[model samples]
Target: MVLDSLGKSLRGVLQKIARGSTVDEALLAEVVRDIQRALLQADVNVQLSLDLTKRVRTRATTEKPPAGASLRDFLIRIIYEEIRGILGKERPFDLKPKRILLAGLFGQGKTTTAGKLARYFQKKGVRVGLVAADVHRPAAVDQLEQLALKVGCEFYSNRAERRAEVIVQEALAHFPAHLAVIVDTAGRSGIDPDLIAELKRVRAVLQPDETLLVLDAAMGQTAGRSAQAFHEAVGLTGVILTKMDGSAKGGGALSAVSASGAPILFLGTGEHIDEFERFEPTRFVSRLLGMGDIQTLLERFDELSDKESAEKAAQNLMSGRFTLRDMRSQLASLGEMGPMSKLMSLFPGIGAAKVDQKTLDATQQRLRRFRSIMDSMTGEELDNPHVIKADRVHRIARGSGQKPQEVRGLLKHYESTKKAAHGLVSNRRLRRQLEKQFGNAEAPAD
Candidate 1:
């Protein structure tokens, strides 16, 4: 709001000038000065911050305002574009795991990153193997060795010598049988002449498919210098900015990207290797510039459930044509919403924080019983559950392995959710976001 108010003030100033009133250069300079202060204070690089203000000043003076575009509108648009150009394209995490070479400062997370990337590929069904080439620093080998267990990948290490080249030769020979291989190399604080020379030797030996620089985003603007030094030393093909979730100065990673001219490939959001998110440039900039991540949510939903069936069921329910068959269809859809506790967590104010596991377990057991009881209905009986009187309930209980009381409870839960889904189908905007995330999941992506 404070920034928006400043934007409004500049808008008013430009509005006056576009209307043909004479404006002194002094006033225009003052406007650019205020804008510069706003951006720089937001943690933009001092030089880039200065260049942005200069571009706005030059354009405001040189170009005739487009018919009625307020000076503020013209200037804001220019600043937005220049900042984007500086931020550049989001580098994708596209390394297909033939072989990746990781290098970083000691304790800057290279081995852990290699393990995480390997495990990520493994989840995607790519066979993965790791070579812990970082032989210096006590148990850099053992540390990666222990961490490799949680990842379910093979880790190769040679403790006999600190020479990284010999490890690379062994890794290259072994990794070919696997779809992916991630190599971890030793790191030293500040550029160690010895370390870079050793990394270059390993790089020569393996000629890795990709070389990723692991940077700690926690270092703020200093990340830029660190990225530059690493790039000059061993050539950076891509960058992984770690620990952004804990940094408010997350924008500093942008500065590092701008400086090193390497695309950002992955973001380490949390401690676990699986906590990485593949960086998407457009969506990322959209979020940074205050647009929400609605598209990502849509993709996640589409990946989870069947779009066509969910839409049809929603349409049928809204037209007052709901049936017991529809309830069965919905059970399939609800299953797409993930485990019952996960479904509950999607409720506002619940996701991210942990929930009580005992309650979740009991609720899930009830769903299983509900599904079993529903299965006991005859085809025609399932289409219209009104036929399920006390006698039907007793028979279903006997057949489905649940008591009559449990059967009745499921009927009540079904009725409540049917009503809620009924109301939701009427709102087109809400329906779209819901459809993306809440339908049938395709047979788990092979």
Candidate 2:
């Protein structure tokens, strides 16, 4: 939910378009004004926002909708294109056997992003290695070593070496054959001559394939200046915006960095090492405007579970045979997809729903507790919840360290969820809509 306020404001404008009987000049003007206001409030550069809205307005009024497309849909497309243009083209980071040097100011999350990048490539079937070149930070080497162990990747650093260049050389020598090395460089409090000099030395020695500048999303309009400085010093291949999940100025940072002509390569979505993702401008803007990103959602599902398993789970839900075990598996899948708010944002219309994070967290916690309680149940009770009578519920409660009423609540939830799933499966219109939205890929047979 980066730039949450901006998303809300743009969604409101789209709602106005949806409500209007026709797309008229007045409506277009209103939409432009609203978008401009939203972008400015998100701390975007004023001139950039104005230019973008102008393009949107011109396209909406002059261009004709596609034969089957509605006027509202055409208008939305124009806005989407204009916003996507401002965000620049997507620059995908390919995980290969090459050295990647990370650079940025202090507290911009460069060290953490280095860890995340290593984990990302490791997940992509690469033998990844991390070289902690941040000799200035007291515990930076230790932090990268711990993250390497956590992700089961190779780690290289030299505490005795005072020069980062020497550390880089030593780390490269020790790296396993064909391993992709990510060098975590030190950052200064500000972009200073000393910092740039140190980075230049490291860069010359490492000869990295990619030099990425990590900028804090909360840096707002200043992100452009920082990116420009790094680009000048190290010839940056791309930029990585960090702390994107919590930054209100995320919009500004993204737009500003894009304006600097360095395509955003990735985003630090959360604190978890696995939360980083490759940046795709079109998909990102689509989700930002509440158009849904099915590809990303599907990728999440694929990461957490195999295709056959997911298809089987879907079949179970459709057939109304969802058991407590199935429910627990679903809960675990949801947990792996990060926060509910973020997952919901990837779904069209659902992002507009006013869901409180506290409520979402509480619901997730309840699901985990339910799973724990189910673990305490007998196998037959999980498969056939109706077999769990009052006495059995009491036993489960005692085993799970909860009251009997709580155990009963879990059973009630299962029943309700099953009923809802049956209702959805029975709705042909809903099925057709999903097929149309997500394409007609058939699920595995029940």
Which residue pairs collide in model 2, if any? none
The number of clashing residue pairs in model 2 is: 0
How many pairs of residues in model 1 come into backbone collision? 7
Runs in model 1 lying further than 4 Å from the true structure:
1-42, 56-79, 293-446
Q: Which residue pairs collide, candidate 1?
A: 301-436, 301-437, 304-441, 305-439, 305-440, 305-441, 306-440
User: Cα deviation of 99 in candidate 2 (Å)?
Assistant: 0.7
339-432 in candidate 2: lDDT tens per residue? 7888877654355554678888898888878878998999898788779988898989999998788898998998898888765444434424
What TM-score would candidate 1 get against the native?
0.56
Best by lDDT: 2
Residue 290 C-alpha lDDT in model 2 = 66
Every candidate's CA RMSD: 15.7, 13.9
Which candidate gets the maximum TM-score versus the true structure? 2
